[model samples]
Target: MGQGLSCAASQDHRFFSAVHFGDLETVNAMLERDPSLLYQTTYDRQYPLHIAAANGQIEILSMLLERSVDPDMVNRQKQTPLMLAAMHGKISCVKKLVEAGANMLKFDSLNGRTCLHFAAYYGHSDCLQAILSAVQSSPVAVSWGYSRFVNIRDGRGATPLHLAARQRRPECVHILLDNGALVCSSTGGYGSPGTTPLHLAARGGSLDCIRELLAWGADRMQRDASGRIPYVVALKYRNGTCAALLNPSSAEPLVWPSPLKFISELNQEAKALLECALMEANREREKNILKGTGYSLPSPSHSDDGTDDNISEASDTELCCICFEQVCTIEVEDCGHQMCAHCTLALCCHNKPNPTTACLTPPVCPFCRSTIARLVVAKMKDCNDADQDIGDGGSPKLRKSRRSLNFSEGSSSFKGLSATFGKMGGRGSGRIAAENEWVDKP
Candidate 1:
């Protein structure tokens, strides 16, 4: 019998490739020659059922199961056909396996996760629904009320709910909750972040899943070992909806920590912006003063030279800054310093006063860090590589030439500087302009 099975196994290999290639009739012919061939295993210990499930071959799976093939048999990794079916979202195959009494509760020997874990992680809603249906119909009183699914850790100590939450599958989260999955279950699995399912959901900013977990009595009060609560995580992420679910009793509507910080940073930015506006007004005033005084404004060439000097000085003193983008508005500081407004805003304001927007700024620039500023500009420049440093205090002749060029309003040239130069292949002008347009566009 063993020898016959071994010979059949070799034939099964040929048939397995045929099956993978969709040669159904050929597979049928091989199996017909040896009825017991339906139960054969391949080099990977994968039976026809495993291949069928993994490949979404419903007909082939049905035929194999009808031959009494073991649907729950595990490979070397202890992953059963049911697990593969659930993972791959083969709904029909999963249903067939469940109907054939494939063990949904069988955990992978390596990961200690049941077939349901795979279904939940992959967001296979149909497969999950079918598995839950089978479990509900089984004689074992399915524990639908205990958050058992939530708390039951896998080899990694992650509950089914954790996988769902981490993958941002709201529907999967709902299914797990309905099946008595716990929201607070943390994995004892090595290197596990020791976070509850709620923590995972909140971190991913899935408000719906977070709400579902909270609705099912997921303990909002429980803090992960990080001393971070799910609500705090939501607030930290600027997810107002999730934060609202966590704290409902505040007299003053609790703002997300990130948004609050954003506002405070915005205030500082507003002041900085106001200062910049004033300085710009002064520069404009100076320009007017020169014009009205009949100082015989230098010839366009001479004026351009002075302008180049100004730009050079500006480039050196003013930091390019971004407010929300790489460069949305050129932030002219009180002292006339400029940078990308968005980058500066991010560096200076995004994280201040709010956990959500924290640490977006680097402490120093890779090149020069006098506290980098984000800049937004009116136009972009298409200068060649040699021209990149033209306005940054280069040769006196280059500076004079830079001053003569007046920026054309609404020109494509005015639309391109990003706060970070690397984005433009180490040039910085184009990004600022691009960010300005992005912010101005509705």
Candidate 2:
């Protein structure tokens, strides 16, 4: 009784300091002198083995385990030494802990994060491999070590896979995917528009990760609670390469319903709208110019020329506003305004240079200049909100207004609403022309 009490008193005094200094010899001598001291814990409920493993003291860790010290004893924080070992990338300590049958799937008290969650998060591939091997051999569907393996969410419902994707660890993503992590796990944080791993990949700008997720059957059109698609997310970030990748037909035109077809249809609708607008503007100009003035009848030479020929010629001379180049193709935005094709393409990208001033992501309706979605704040409410009416084909219903756009008045060289046409004031005699229909020759 006296020997036991003396050994206990001596160990109690040295326990905290010995563990802190990683004194394997003192720890072994104490354990040898009193075998029961192996179970003696510190104030924080950490066994000698726990501290050794946490601090990456592999020699002391191995000795403690060989003497039958419990490897699964958690600290007051409810974190096993294994959790610390994995998190800190201690390969040898991780191996000792795993070999000792430490609870691989044990969750931390606070975040409910498991050891694999920690290992994968910190990119400890060797330790992760050991854990996976142990996991595969366990009887439970999710190994007991991973029983709480971060497959489920916290109060917010973000899974471990979600965290990995967000952290942008490609290797971690691969490991999780190989270990059967769900690709489509959703969170309440985003509502029905909860972000999938692909969403995280999009946010991380990992093109390879994005492709891998897609190969694993990630839905490209899967929208978040706000109905924002992956490509739309890419656009808001100004990732043009991703935007074009999502829409295969953007580079080379594809068949029906492709980006090209979609763009073409939108262009036609915009042209029809522009044609009506241009006619009105032309009438106003003619009325303003001819008002209170006596005009002579046109000569036979002028009268015989084709009106269509002149309008076609005039349309060809109009330059793209953003690029200052002659327009190639054109696209109309939700705001009922027009821009060159390249400018429209640039606006929807997340990777193009200098996008804020030149690009037009949604929520900033390209034409009306309204903030569609606040990119800076990451708000991606669906373009078709209940408050905003979407027409038959998911296009927003344009608000009607008397404000009309005039080609000459808005043109760079047209100089303050003058009705007189200069000799070199572009091809058409007096009218706006359709796209690609501009007359190249008289």
Candidate 3:
């Protein structure tokens, strides 16, 4: 027994050293001498496969897999070799492990996070795409459905989307969204309940991430457990640009001439004419308003005796002017008038018209007859709310403000918006034009 124990220990030291340094020849020779050395665990319970994958030794990893080593063997943290490879951004190693039948859906017992989650958290876009492709092509994924693994949530109830957004991985965010990852999925773990990917993006101050999420139909009006929407979170973190983009007032209102006519069906010439007309009309209206000669449009009325009724309504200490239920926690921009974030977002940003209109109406301040420039999240004093604690120890924490908005150096361009008629022949326009043909037919 003593002799066997000594031999195993000696073999483990040499095997671990060889795998750690990626000495392919030494690893193969040792494995040939002691076939069982491939399965031997180090002091940390990490196998030769885990070491090779972690260190990005693709050649050694390939050799181990070809020798029929267990691909799914996990370490003390319950992290498999595939997870290690993904977390370290070893794309080639990850692909090899996946092709060799590594368990892609296996989650770490500690956090219940899958390999995709690790790849996303580490900002490995290529690694993430490879894992996604492997899953889609796998027979098990085909039988069980790819979404089952793609949307797998961690113990904290956070999906891979949440991690990508939180880590400010714009490429990973786009890849995940393109693959049908849920945008509005909320988390109930790690002191964050009902926190969506938009909230995470806002907190991280990732403008590209925010844009991607919004383009993918993320609900900005969705609130966290603290009753704060992504816009409010952006303001709280001083991400002014993100907040402005999310503000409904910043979007130009599209006025359709006819309810039956679809914007997509309009030909290039017709669309140009309509745009010119709208521009002329806006210029004339602005000039008239500036000259005080324009006809008065219907607006909210003020109170008699020189007291603003709107201000009074907003200043109601007992009730919120927007929701009329919850207490006020958010304040409108440029006007100190208060309202709940939930109500502010719903009243200003989420008020969608019928399908015929297909336009977004800008939100105005209820207390003041001015257009809402932006919304600011007021800092609460002595608040012990669980949602207020947004730290996860090792992950990126929300900052009061960032020096710059340029998070990702990659291209910021994304396709999903309604294509303009002028750019019909451009790249990505073919699909949009094809889809709109049915609208113009008959």
TM-score winner among the candidates? 3
Candidate 3 residue spans exceeding 4 A from truth: 1-11, 188-193, 252-442
Tens digits of per-residue lDDT for model 3, 1-442: 9999998788789889889898999988887888888778888899889999999999999998888888999999999999999999999999999889898878898889999999999999999999998888798587768877778899888899999999999899988976778878899755565889999999998866876676556776788999998889988998765676555433322222221223334445434433333332222222223233232323221111223223332223323433333345566557766554333433432234455866544455554545665555544433233124434322221221110122111213211111222112111111112222211100
| Per-prediction TM-score | 0.49, 0.47, 0.57
lDDT of 3: 0.64
Q: Candidate 1's error at 287, in angstroms?
A: 46
lDDT of each: 0.56, 0.53, 0.64
CA lDDT of 124 in candidate 1? 94
Of the two candidates 2 and 3, the one with more favorable TM-score, higher being better, is 3
Question: Order of candidates by lDDT, top first?
Answer: 3, 1, 2
Local error of candidate 1 at 124, Å? 1.0
lDDT of 1: 0.56
Candidate 3 deviates by what RMSD? 22.4
Instruction: Compose the digit string of candidate 1's lDDT tens values, residues 1-442.
Output: 9999787657767888876666778878887887766666777777777888899888888877787777777887899999999999989888888788887667787778888789889999888878777776674336442334334568767777888888889888877765556455666445444688878787787755654565444666667777787778887887655565455231111111122223234444354543333222222222332443334322231122332223443233122332211222443322233444334332332133324854343223222233434332323333444256454657544453443232223223222322322221101321112212111000
Top-lDDT candidate index: 3
lDDT of 2: 0.53
Once fitted onto the true fold, the runs of candidate 1 whose alpha carbons sit more than 4 angstroms away are 1-13, 34-40, 142-151, 188-194, 231-442
